[model samples]
Target: MKFTTYLRQGAPRLAVVDGGDLIDLNDADAQVPADMRAALRAGADLQAAGRRAIQAGKRQALDGTKLAPLVPEPGKIICLGLNYYDHAKEGGREKPDYPWFFFRAASSLVAHGEAGWLPRVSSRFDYEAELAVVIGTAVPRHTTQADALGHVFGYACFNDMSVRDYQKRTPQWTIGKNFDRTGGFGPVLVTADELAPGATGLRIQSRLNGQVMQDANTDDMIFSVAETIALLAEVLTLEPGDVIVMGTPAGVGQARTPPVWMKAGDTIEIDIERVGLLSNPIANEAA
Candidate 1:
């Protein structure tokens, strides 16, 4: 089952997409009617109930309405860096022996179809199209690959936009990655059962202002989704509502000859096979 969060009158609510229209789960108390976050915290029971309710609902077609991030406000946003060999080589860095990780504050998340703000904080804004994993259960240190997947709730599309100038200057990538309204995530949360952890043949791509920037398949990932979960579980406790953004592929703006940074009015679209396209307009940050 696919789940989504959408804005209705400036408030975020959990919803399920049938064909086109979104089914307001909050309105129908037939199942676990809590919000997406709350339901995630409640674990499997609520997820099952929500799925059942969504399947039973009368399909409503949404005609080009805005979609909020699948997991709008996760407790944690763990991101992997240079997990792709091509991306690592492009950055003039050797492939890491282990998964290099960083964190993006929950405040940076922007929903699908929402406008992405180009902050005055930096001028080298860039885009990264990635596949993100959403955690479903609490997992402490030293978990096996099998144990790792047992903690996953679902998967979603993640666009980890960056500011190249700020990122390269500092050893830590948080500043460039955690800029407000830059991380685009959404379309919907596809349940773990709906997708095989590493077997899904998903193709991820990004287009900036009608020009294709990045194109790659999940199979090319240096670290598979299951491996990432297992590796992270060895150090940090993975909890429900925590999201992991697997690193992106090559063809980013910073890597281009004449760095094609985003400008106000530019449109960025990321498409992941199986997971629908997430498109957002670029706008100047508010004064």
Candidate 2:
């Protein structure tokens, strides 16, 4: 089942995509949470409720509905860097035995169709297309990589926008990666069962305007979802609504001949096989 979050009466409301329409889960059944986070925490019971709602056949046209970040406020927005070998080689970085993790704040999230700000202080905005995993179950420490993927709920396309200057100012990438509205989170979340295990072997790409800029397959990731989860679980409990942005590929604008950067009025899009498309417009922060 495909799930999405949109605004209803000024607050986030969870919906299940049925063909070209969306069924508002809350309206269909009160047992279904009104938001994605709550539904995730509700676990299997919520899934059953959503299935029942679909059976009831109450749905609204999906076109142009206002959307909210898929998770709105993920407890942790963890990201991987240089998770693709080609991307690592292109960026002049060596492959590490461990995943390079970073965090993006909830404040930086912008949903699909929303405007992502081009910060006034920098013109070096670059796009990194990635596959983001949403955790559904709480994972305990010492979980094996083999068992780690069972904790995932679903997957979504993500564009991890970055401000180059600030990212280079310090060894830590938090400043550069945390610019408000830089994280393009979703259009819809495709349940884990709908895709190949660990979401590997899927094609992922990014488009600038209508032109394709980054293209690669999820199979290229250096750290698989299960491995990354196990690695992360060692450090902290992976809880429901926590997200893991499985790093981008080799075609980012930063590696271009003279470099390419996003500016006002540009549209950036991320398309991951099975996950769905996530697109956003760029606007000047001051505007």
Candidate 3:
């Protein structure tokens, strides 16, 4: 089932998407929490409740509501860099034997249709389309790849917008990746059961304004979700609501002949097959 979070009465609320309508899970069943992260922590029982809620016929049209990040305050937002072979090659690097991981602060997140601010300090902002994995169950350290997939709840489209200059300031990418309101995180989260295991072989693409920029298949990733999770779990525990943003593909702006950057009034979109499309508009920081 597809799930999303949206603003209702000025607070974030979880809903189950049914076609173009949204069924407020909390309203339908008081047992279900209003927050997507909390509902996810409740485990599969909440999904069963959500299914019942959808059957109760208490949905509202989705268009009028303001969407929120799928998990508004994910405990951890782990991202992989150079995980795609083609992307590595484009960056003038060889395929990596291990996934390069980084963290994105919660404050950096923005939901679909929201404005992704182009910082006044820099105009070299670029987009990286990625697949975001939302953790469901707590995974213990040393878990095997075979068991890692079970801990995933869902997947969503992610646009890992970067400020290229800040990214190169230091070897670590934290500063460049964590600019406020740069992470495009939602539209909808498709439960793992709804797609192929590990979400492999899906078409992922990025479009700036109306033109396609990055285009590739999830299968091209050198580190699969299960493998990345297992490797990460070996060092740290994976908790529910933690998100893993699998890396982008070959066509990033920095590698282009004439680097393409996102500027005010532009719209950036990341569309992942079977997951959903996440779109954001660009605006000056003051706007």
Candidate 4:
């Protein structure tokens, strides 16, 4: 089942998407949490409740609804760098034996239909189309790859926007990546069961102002979802509501001839086959 988190009276509400309508799950069953993170923490029982709501609850028009970031506030937002071969080559880097992990603060996330801030201090912002995984269960430390899939709840499309100037100021990427509202996170969350095992072999792309900037397949990823999780679990527990953004493919604005940074008024889109499309307008960060 597809799930969406949208705003009602400026507060987030969890709903199940059904044929152009949204069924508010919490309204259908008070037992279900109104937040996606909370609901997922509630476990499989909440999934059953969502299914029942799709059949018996009232439906609300999905159009004109204001969306919220899929998780709103993920405890840990881990990202991979140079996980795609061509992407590494574009930046004059080698395919590494281990995943290059980075973290993004919760304040950086911007929901679909909202604007992605282009910091006034820099115009070197770039777009990265990536597949983001939403962890559903708490993974025990040292879990195996075989058991990692059980911890995933769903998948979503993500635009891992970058502030190139700040990113290059230091070797660590956290400062540049944590610019408020730079990460475009969701429109809908497609459960893991809805796609192929590990979400492999799917096409993912990024478009800027209607032109395709990046086009590649998930098959190009150096590390698959299960492998990444297993590796992560070996060090720390993967808790529910945590997000893992698989790295992007080659065609980013930074690697292009003469560069192509996003400016105010440009719109960026991330389309991940079978997951969903996430679109966000570019806007200058308010002074």
Which has the greatest lDDT? Answer: 4
lDDT of 4 by residue, 1-287 (tens): 78989998999898999879999999999988899888877774556877899889999888778999988989899999999999999999999899999999889999999999989899999999999999998999999999999888889999999999999999988888989999999999998988988899899999999999999999999999999999998899988899999999999999989999999999999999988899999999988
lDDT: worst 10-residue window of model 3: 41-50
lDDT of each: 0.81, 0.91, 0.91, 0.92
Clash list (residue pairs), candidate 3: none
Q: Per-residue lDDT tens digits of candidate 2, residues 74-176?
A: 9999999999999999999989789989999999999999999999999999999999999999999989998998889889999899999999999989899
**Candidate 3: deviation at residue 123, Å?**
0.5
Candidate 1, residues 1-287, lDDT tens digits: the string is: 77788877877778777666677776665445446777767653645556665777544655576667778788889999998888888989888889789999878889888888898877788999988888888877988887778777778888898988888778888888988899999888777887766535789899998889998888878888888888887788888888899999888898889888988899999998887788888999878
Off by over 4 Å in 4: none
Q: Score every model by TM-score.
A: 0.93, 0.98, 0.98, 0.98
Model 4, residue 103: displacement in angstroms?
0.6
Give the clash count for each candidate: 4, 0, 0, 0
In candidate 3, what are the lDDT values of residues 1-287, reduced to their tens digit? 98899997778898999899999988898878889888777764656876898899488888867998889999999999998899999999998888889999999999899999899999999999999999999999999999999999999999899999999999999999999999999899998999999999899999988799989999998999999999998899998899999999988888998888889999999999989989999999963
